[model samples]
Target: MTTQVQSGGMVNTTLMGGGALLVVGLGLALANLMTGGHASFNSGSDGVTWGLPVVNYVFFALTSTGLTLVASLALTFGNKAFYPIAKRCVFLSLITLVAGFASLALELGHPFRMLFAVPLNFQVNSPLNWMGVFYAVFLVLGVLKFMKLHASDWDSDTSKQVGLAALVTECLAGGMLGMAFGAMAMRPMWYGTLVPLYFLLTAACTGGAFALLMTYLTYGSESAMPEKVRALVQGPLPAALAAVLGFTILVMGYQTVIGLWSNADGMQVWDHIVSTPWFWIEAGALVAAFYLLVSRSSLMVAAMLIILGLFINRYEFVIGGQLVPLFKGTWVAGMISYTPSITEWMLTVMAFGIVLAGWAFGEKAFNLSDAPKE
Candidate 1:
């Protein structure tokens, strides 16, 4: 009883703290809008037009998609191990996607206009347009699926069907998100078919990591976890994570090697990228994360490391692509520099604040444990 009370108190404290951060972030975002819009951001006409907020958007968006995909293993594929926490994954997916939208809202000059423009002005050739549509569908399907899961006590054919639909939509959305960058022929660094596959791979990694982290947090320790959940986390989950991390490492390594060997103007940015301390930090984090997973040292630590590495990886990908000025030698001299402003950082805080609060609320309101069999 004492332990339960302590846990409740901790959750309440987290909720309040997250709420405060959200309020502060929103205040800063409003201040930014009033004070000349994009001027507060570090982006300029010549370089890095898509800055930190964009990175945050991509990070949260892909994480949400990944969560949906991972949840499908239980809901759609009938993976018994995942059944215990599948609902929580769905909940997190919805919250993270909303947080992503919030970041995007702050990034855009007039976010409200998009609500009207996107639906009214259909651009068939636009990957972004299709991406938006798919995500919107995903959000709707996810909500319906969650509702059905709760209504049917977490086991029903209807919920499974919806989960499958959500999974498909999430895949389409994630792929289109990558295509949004890959299709830009002008951005030579980003112009490739691999980008979409890379996005999906990293998405799976993040999703799995998040699931593991949440499981540990919810249960407190392996000993505290139910036998079924413990078995899943100890055996299958870690094995899957290790495999994905290995693939990610291979892809990233090859990307670096190929970039160095190429003489393309945009590929030259890899030379600069490899020299940066951040790049090494990103690589080190992933390698360390992989080691932790493989050696079965600490799943929580590995998850944290993977999340951090992925954030840095996304940051480098977005910023590095724009570093090499499009009109090199003619207008720009060398690589462009970018540092996210205070406003952008605060907005990131806001997104995390939302996640923290949402998770706490979900824990408080819902029974996240394995559903009782009918």
Candidate 2:
């Protein structure tokens, strides 16, 4: 009854799991509202905690940004190698960007202020304010691109130019968050030259992961992609996975080093994260995820584990980054211990739900599983 795409390499069930995960993530939100985050965040105990919700913001941004990068490689650059997946990449990037925004909104204590304040008040120093500007510009350009897709006269040179311009703006806007991290002179943890590149590399992996899952769900195992897609994905996916893994180690290794010598905040964070047993759990999951790339039997298991690793990475980053004595002098090793509060946790769960629901809605809106036939 339905149309066919690829033929027989992927397992149909993996796609099913992807759908189920969407539900589970969403379902957790409802459960959280009913039962509560179970983890309390007393402001007295944790300080005015921002929690992992912000990390979700970063992750969502990574996902969207990565998709945008890959899409650009395919479309604007005229890379025939990437064309098969270009459309899906663009649409998926859009989906992830929206989800990231949703998560950020949920995490905010003053969401209404952010929404209304920027346009009215306009503070440029605030990264959030700049992001608002970025988002508005990107959204307008994106609409222009979307319009080209539906327009009968899209083949006209003017329309193509508009689409191309939109894609470029999207990438720049999408990269804003990543650049923000790298450009922070005050935060030693975030200031590394490689941090922005790290963001881009991980973004590609996340985007590829999303595409793979989408393809699996729609076509189920037998994707008879053009030779270009075949080569690009086969080489690209593993490369991304490896780069991300290496970047995680580099970041963590520096922390471990800092903790041993200096009483720096990042070092202090290193102490907590490394000292914990869950550190191994996180590390092990990442290793296993990368290892699965070479395996034929259980890519799904590995993918699941990698996703778990990603979550732990985010969790550690969120919790560990704040645990450091931010305001206190270097002599004070620990001024904060962070545990997510019920509100923070609930918001995270809700954010996950929103992402899943949004993705599901996204699938119906665009043929996110299909790329342009090269």
Top TM-score: which candidate number?
1
Local lDDT at 49 for model 1: 90
TM-score of each: 0.94, 0.75
User: Residue 12 of candidate 2: its Cα lDDT?
Assistant: 36
Please, what is the whole-model Cα lDDT of each candidate in the order they appear? 0.83, 0.58
Per-residue lDDT of model 1, residues 1-374, tens digit only: 00121243245666788788888987887798688687888888788899999998899899998888778887888777777778779988998899988998888878899999878889999999999999999999999988876664456667777888999999999999999999888877888987999999999888888788877767677877767777878888888889998999899999888888988878888998899998899899999999999988798899999989988888888888899887757677588877899888888889988876887677677655545363
Model 2 CA lDDT for position 272: 65
User: What are the per-model numbers of colliding residue pairs?
Assistant: 0, 10
lDDT of 2: 0.58
Query: How much does each candidate deviate from the true structure in C-alpha RMSD?
Result: 2.7, 5.0
The clash number for model 1 is: 0
Least lDDT summed over 10 consecutive residues: which range in candidate 1? 1-10
Query: Judged by lDDT, which candidate is best?
Result: 1
